[model samples]
Target: MSRIQANLLLLVIALIWGSAFVAQSQGMADVGPMLFTGVRFLIGAAVVAPLAWREWKQLARQGKTPTATDARHIGGLGLLMLVGAALQQVGIISTSVTNAGFLTALYVPLVPVLSWLWLRQLPHWSVWPGALACLVGAFLLSGAHELNIGVGDLWVIASALPWAVHVLFVGRVADKLAAPFLVACGQFLVCGSLALVYSLFMEPVSLKGLIAAAGPIAYTGVLSVGVAFTAQVVAQRYAHAADAAIILSSETLFAAVFGYLMMGDRLNPAGFAGCALILGSMLVIQLLPLFRMGRHKPASVLDHPV
Candidate 1:
């Protein structure tokens, strides 16, 4: 793809993902959070599996195909996403849509820190400051409420930490494997299976909720889980490691916008300030790469979805 085309693809994907904040916020009104997430992911897997099938067939014809290790790597990646996404969804149940949106976005900076701590390498200076800004935003946003740390908010923070790990894992996985196909297969199978299992155990979903929320459920299942996820897989291939992190962070802004438009939720002054700081921190990390002074990953060469 041309540079403009690649960047545009990533931008479009980011927009889809960012907009899903609305779908998720609306999804909880009709269904239990666990049930909603499980259902959406089940739909996600169904949509993505076919995309992977063609790639698998092409590789089979070539004979020299995916190694056993590659399958295991994919398994690990899928599992990471499965756990992180599940937690984030469940967390939203207790938290306000606004708080959840802001808190979960902390993963953008957490990625580099997690990488640094795991590898014994220092994160760039910007990583620490950005992470701090995220925490402050989280505190400001969540602190305004009763401050009764709900199960859902706790779940989201847990999700944020793991989501950071998932981001790092994506970089490695995209580098080692045929990115889009591997990502599609992993998300399809793992999240799909886990969602089904979780649905059976934690959330015996009622037919009424499903019927009442069909529009919302479908929006999330198809657009948020299926299309947005596909864009993430493809875009990650063409994004620098840090750029991928920054792009994904746009979900918060989109979330805020949707909240205002759909829910009549307007941020207070403090909230707006917090949001600005978080966004500014992310932009600095993404746009001022040299300021961070780290060895960033280059965009991967991968096939784009039509």
Candidate 2:
């Protein structure tokens, strides 16, 4: 697929994820975060299982042998997914959809920073301006007027690291795997298994509660995890990781819109301003690369290696 097509797919993923915020928030009322995430991912795994199996079978027919390193990477992806999802689900319970969405977007900037720190690969100079904008926006969105941060917001912020790592890892692995669906399935399976273990030991899980939240669980599981995540894997194969991140980050915008329409969510003036800044940052990051590419002597590629 072309990069533009891949980005469009990422945008669709963002919309699905943004729409899922309400479902996830509502699901919390009837079940614990761990239980909800566990069940939701299990459904996601099941939804993708047929495709995953087909891919695996096709690979086997070609006499391809999976390596230990591949298994390790898949395992790591699942663990990262589990951590990121758990924190995000729990964080949403105490924060507004607006707050959660903006805060979660901190991952966009964090992605480049993590890349620099962990991989020793410096991001394009343009990243600084966008990252600065996002940082300021995050502070403002965290109730800068009141000079306080919500606990849930903190959790969401903490989750950003794992989310960034997950995206980077996915970018690294996207080209290495022949079966994106199979890899996605492995991730969902491991994530769901871990979440289930946590729910079983620490959270109270009831069939009645799961049934009560069936609509929400189904929405998040089937669309958000199953379809959106699979799309992400495929999109990343054709698009730059940074571009993919920026496109996926539109989830914040869609989440805010969906939250306002569905849940009567309203942010104060400062909060709105913060959201605007964050949106601006995303646009800046996306456009900077185009500008650089147009120059006679481009300084660096905006799409840095993952």
Candidate 3:
């Protein structure tokens, strides 16, 4: 797929995830965050297992075997997912949804920074301005009038590091893995298992709460985790992590739109401006590469269509 197509897939993921924010909020109302995360991701694991099995069988037919190194990479990805999700869930309980959403998007800028530090991949020139715009847009979309670093905000901020790492890891491993579905399944299983273990030991969990949050859990697990996350793993193979992160940051805008549609929450002028800025960032990021490539011959893989 082309970079543009990959970006479109990520945008769809943002939409699905954004709309599911309400379900996440409702799910947390009756259950501990850890327990809720465990159950929902377990559901996601179950939903994706068959697809992973099919991929495994195809690889087997092709005489390809997964190595221990592949297992280790998958495990690492899972651990990153677990850390980011746990922190976000805990932070969500202590912060407003708007705060959680906006703060989580700090990963947009963080992705490029992490990539530069770990992978020695400098972000495209466009990424700096695009990420900045997206961050500001996310803030406005969140409807926060003041910047306060609460415990929850701190947790969310910490979570962004793992999330940024996760995006880079996905981009790295997606090409190495035989099938992205298997990577998704493995990560979900690991993340879910970790959360389940933690919930059993530290959190109050009950079958009753699980049943109470069944609808939300199923929606998030099946659609958001299973489908959307798998799309991310597949798409990132074709897109720059920094660009993908900026695109996904538009989730806050989608969340605002969904909030208005589902809960009768109205967007103020700031929210509308936020929406415009995010869209503008996307356009800039998309077209800037093309313009630069036109002026000068392509110098790197990213300069060409995938």
Candidate 3 lDDT, tens digit per residue, 1-306?
876788899999999978777777778878888887887788888888998999889988888767788889999999999999889888877776666778888999998888778767787788899999989988887776566668987887789998998987786675776488898999999999989999999987888888998888889889989899888888887788888898998888777777777756677888788889999998898788887765764222233221
Over 285-304, each residue of candidate 2 has an lDDT whose tens digit, in order, gives 76676665656433222234
Order the numbered candidates by lDDT, best leading. 3, 2, 1
Q: After superposition, how far is residue 17 of candidate 3 from its true place, in Å?
A: 1.2
* Residue-level error in angstroms, candidate 2, position 162: 0.8
Q: Tell me each candidate's RMSD, in Å, in order.
A: 4.4, 2.8, 2.6
The lDDT leader among the candidates is 3
Question: Model-by-model lDDT, in order?
Answer: 0.66, 0.80, 0.82
TM-score of 2: 0.89
> What does the lDDT come to for candidate 3?
0.82
Clash number for candidate 2: 0
1 against 2, candidate with superior lDDT: 2
- Evaluation by TM-score, superior candidate among 2 and 3: 3
Q: Which candidate is the best by TM-score?
A: 3
Candidate 1, 42-116: lDDT as tens digits: 787677778777777777887847787777777777787778777887777666666677667778777766656
Better of 1 and 3 by lDDT: 3
Off by over 4 Å in 1: 1-11, 120-125, 130-149, 290-306
Candidate 2 regions with alpha-carbon error over 4 angstroms:
135-145, 267-275, 291-306
Q: How accurate is candidate 2 locally (lDDT)?
A: 0.80
